[model samples]
Target: MKIATYNVNGVNGRLPVLLRWLEEEQPDIVCLQELKAAQDNFPEGAIRNLGYDVVWHGQKSWNGVALLSRVGKIHETRRGLPNDPDPSQSRYLEAAVNGVLIACLYLPNGNPRPGPKFDYKLVWFDTLIDHAATLAASGAPVVLAGDFNVMPAERDVYKPQRWVDDALFAPEVRAAFFRLLDQGWTDALRTIHPDETIYTFFDYFRNAFARNAGLRIDHFLLSPALKDRLVDAQVDRQVRGWEKTSDHAPVWIVLADR
Candidate 1:
């Protein structure tokens, strides 16, 4: 089945581009981040008309997450990161679709490092790592996919040095991402294409997308049980340059039928 992750930037503003993508890609399941809308503003009817079921956790003008499944009932497992000390941002949501556990997350883009925002980013990562441990223990085929807001390695970014002070590439952030993989989840895109020359996001500024200057912050991580079934993986870079497009693009992974 095809599973895809996309950060639409804003659900209302990008409805046309998003719906077109859904109709074209036709993924069995989709995990969306950065809906940037309130629960009541989520364009439910528009998506429902596309023949998919959705479960979303939304906030006003910032972070949000959603799961759309065409194969089974979208079972919401959790809304925000449970047990978090602070309760401010709506950045995570978990659900089960088509017998696979899925998580849609919009990890904080902690800019201006050495500050509270960056600290929160690290704390959030810890929370997600804890959640990953629980999912691993369940022995289910888990697919944690979304805009992690992390550049896994220097190669994942255009100029690593330029973003050195940014939270996305901060040493602490990279370590947290590695910790998740150490917990037994395979980085699907990196796994199938281990060459280390792929990207999933680009800054709208500085003609990043036009020049193909991008970062691979978006990801699809799979459980080891689903590793061998990995068939295809790619970043749909073309979507990033479309009219009224988001800074991020779609990342997709296809798995063999069990």
Candidate 2:
């Protein structure tokens, strides 16, 4: 099975680029973040025309998440965290597809440290940690994939020192991410390509893509029951260079059949 995650930034604005990539990759399942569209604004027809089934949770002009599965039916499991600090924000969507519990999330950017937004980020992280524990304990084949908005390790950032003060790299945030991993979820990409300097996002400014100044913020965390099936993981790195494309790239993982 092949599953992928991408932060499209805006669903309608990036429909062309999205459809193009979907055509090229044809992953069995896709978890999309940052739709930036209202519930009624999702480009369902465009995607359905491509022969995929989609379920989305949207909020106008802000965070949103969606799931696409071409392999089989998508049984929606949840739309947000058990105690999401900010339920008003459409940040999470979960479903059962092809026998795996898939979670699509878009963590807060939480810019400008030492402020409410930053505090909210931490609280939200704790909520996610709490919810993840239940999923981890369930021992189901679960895969949490999305733009987590944190660089968990120094190696995940292009220039670690420069971002130390940034919310995404704040020590507290990284620790929260590790706390979730401690529940037995494997970081698929890092586990497969550990010493490689791989990245999935680049700033649109300063020619970041051309210079390869990027960050690995998007991720796929596989539950203990699913980790052993991990066979391959990859980032569609060049997609970030495409015209009018999202700063983030698509990431995918291949798994052995159950």
Candidate 3:
């Protein structure tokens, strides 16, 4: 099965671009982040017309997440990340599709570091780490995919030194990501293309996309049970160049049938 993750930026504004990609790629499963629309604003009918079953958690003008399945029913499991007290953001959604547990997440973009936003980002990562450990121990075929908003290592970014003060590349943030991986989840893309400098997001400023200056922030983490099933992984970098497109592109993976 082909599974993909994309940060659409705003689902309503970029629905056309999303539709075009869906038609072209035809992935069996898709996880979308940054809908930036309210629940009522989600174009459910339009997506359903494409033969996909979707479950989404949406918020107004901010974070949101959704899971789409073409091969089977998407049995929603949860709408928000566990352990988040008074969680108001729609940043996480989980579902069971085709016997696999899929967690779609839009981690916080803690810009302008050394502040409350950055602190929140770290706290959120802690919650995710705690939850991921439990999921990994469950021994289920699980895929935790989405825009993590983190550059795992210096190699994952275009200029490591330049982003030293940036929250996305901060040592603490990177450490949190590693802590999650330590729970026995395999980074699918890095696993497949170990030495390659693959990237999924490019800044709109400074002609970053044109210059191939990007960061590999979107990811698919496969649990141990599904690690061997990972067949291929790639970033649809060209999609970033489309008109009125999102700053991020799609990152996808293929898994062999069990």
| TM-score, per-candidate, Cα-based | 0.97, 0.99, 0.99
Regarding lDDT, does 1 or 3 come out ahead? 3
- Clashes by residue pair, model 1: none
Residue 175, model 3: lDDT of: 94
Q: Tens digit of lDDT per residue, candidate 1, span 76-98? A: 98888878646567788888788
Q: What lDDT does the true structure give each of the candidates?
A: 0.88, 0.94, 0.94
Candidate 3 lDDT, tens digit per residue, 1-258?
Answer: 999999999999999999999999999999999999999999999999999999999999999999999999999998887887338999889999998999999989888799989989998989989989989999999999999999999899998999999999999999999999999999999999999988999999999998989999999999999999999999988899999999999999999999
Give the Cα error of residue 19 in candidate 2, in Å: 0.1
Screening candidate 3 with a backbone cut-off below 3 angstroms (N, C-alpha, C), the clashing residue pairs are: none
Clashing pairs in 2: none
Q: Ten residues in a row with the worst lDDT in model 1?
A: 81-90
Tens digits of lDDT, candidate 2, 103-157? 9999988888979999998998898889899999998999999999999898899
Worst 10 residues of 3 by lDDT: 78-87
